[model samples]
Target: MNTSDDDLLDRAFLALADPARRRIIARLSRGPATVNELAEPFAISKQAVSKHIQVLEQAQLVTRSRDAQRRPVHLDPARLEALTAWIDRYRLVREEQFRNLDAVLSEQAASRGRQTKDPS
Candidate 1:
């Protein structure tokens, strides 16, 4: 089966959904990490961590560099930028909506107070 572009990015977000996976990405932000290094802090098995790595690899969020037997994973800045752009699109709209709602509420409250006071 062929994977679509959306499917690939969706996979990236899903991979990042787990805290452990996010931590792995965070560690990679500093530098590349071997499977063993990534598994060290987590209670899960190396296989489990490897599974998460596999997901990240599929998303292109993490790229494995061939260095002998060690296929250390590195964070892909492009993938992160894609995710940021996707999030920011909706975030800006919601922020604007909240600002508008705040203004509306303030206007309503002020009008209500004016009505409560002596009105000619």
Candidate 2:
């Protein structure tokens, strides 16, 4: 809810809006990979892959660090957890609303049954 949070979410969603970026995130989910390795599976050039990685980086969804001789891109679970928590909050509210409606319907049905079984 704050502006910063909204901005972060906007960047995260926008970064993931592209198919290539989504695929890159999927690949990173498995494990960390260097730019070259990340680019190998796609038809786009390594530079394009790097650009996608930059977007992901800005979104805080991914981080890159030097490992030995290569820099590997790694998924940031904290950012993902933040996103998941935000989504789950709304999902839980919706689920509770549905449950409340179901209970109301059940009570109405029970009341109708009682009426039907009465003297008349």
Query: Could you estimate the TM-score for every candidate?
Result: 0.76, 0.77
Badly placed stretches (over 4 Å) of model 2 are: 1-3, 67-69, 103-120
Which 10-residue span in candidate 1 carries the lowest summed lDDT? 111-120
What is the per-residue lDDT of model 1 for residues 1-120, given as tens digits with 9 covering 90 to 100? Answer: 446879977897898899999999899999988999999999999999999999998888988889999998989889889888988999999999999999999988877856556687
Tens digit per residue, CA lDDT, model 2, 1-120: 344878999989899799999998898999999999999989999999989998899889999899798999999989988888989999999999999999999988877745555557
Q: So what's the TM-score on candidate 1?
A: 0.76
Q: What global local distance difference test value does model 1 have? A: 0.90
The deviation in Å at residue 56 for candidate 1 is: 0.5
In candidate 1, stretches whose alpha carbon ends up further than 4 angstroms from where it belongs are 98-120
